[model samples]
Target: MADFDEPLCGCLQDMFSCLIVFCVPCGGICIQAYSVDKATSSGMVCPFLWSCCLGCIGSAVNRGQIRQKYHIEGSFIMDCLISCFCGCCAATQEYREVMNRERPK
Candidate 1:
């Protein structure tokens, strides 16, 4: 299985994502969720509410989804821990992974 496109600590490499995640984590998570699934983005209010109330759980789920989609090697427990302890970094790394992988060459 492949690993994450970028390391968790590599969050700093993408300054824009890092700044957004650091300053407005929920918004960053919303964007990441949207990028993964447009249908989810339509219900902006619901996601925003969830992000506010269950940010860690939401992020961990989202991280797992990303890992599944990209075939990245990781477990849900690790995702949970990363999302819980390094929320901003995890969000930033997720954002970068999606953007980097999905972007056209």
Candidate 2:
């Protein structure tokens, strides 16, 4: 009975751990998805509006560093989503710049 209880406890712990790892990322992605939809509907791809995404990504980076130093299961995954979205936006800006630079009069 004791051995069975230990395994059960371990499994429960693992489930909680996984949830903590994913929850922040899920939230961040939802926000970014909304941002995209809003941008498309408005017909304005405002790079300045993406500053919020940068903030979220910065938070994630900070959390990741905290986790590294303290070994805490902080919400660092949010950082990943933010970073990905920000990177995509930045790349798009660079592409636009290059295209404009090559445009003929």
Candidate 3:
């Protein structure tokens, strides 16, 4: 099972990210997806487009990528549901995970 530095309750754990996502969903999603993918600006376009136009698909894809990269214990369907229903929270959690991983260990 994949280990997470924090649980999925990013709203409770990360108020800043949660607030950002809540205020500007598209920008927040773009930043979170881009950061998690660890890619250049060109690569950020796809996720940014998807997130801006198709939130469900974008969030699901981003969550799936993060899960696979970290061997997180979750199914694609679950990721979809989370993305569909709890997008802000999910993205915030994913963002936190990426930030945590990037921090010095």
lDDT of 2 by residue, 43-97 (tens): 2233234434455554344324323433434355644563555533322322232
- TM-scores of all candidate predictions against the true structure: 0.79, 0.23, 0.80
Please, what are the lDDT tens digits per residue for candidate 3 over residues 1-105?
865666777466777777788787475786566656662223666766667777787778777777777777888788889888877778788888877776678
| TM-score of candidate 1 on Cα atoms, chains taken together | 0.79
Worst 10 residues of 3 by lDDT: 33-42
Better of 1 and 2 by lDDT: 1
Give the best candidate by TM-score. Answer: 3
What is the number of backbone collisions in each predicted candidate, taken in the order shown? 0, 1, 0
Poorest lDDT segment (10 consecutive residues) of candidate 1: 38-47
TM-score winner between candidates 1 and 2: 1
- Candidate 1: clashing pairs of residues: none
lDDT of 3: 0.72
lDDT of each prediction vs. the true structure? 0.72, 0.36, 0.72
Ranking by TM-score: 3, 1, 2
Question: What RMSD does each model have against the real structure?
Answer: 2.8, 19.5, 2.5
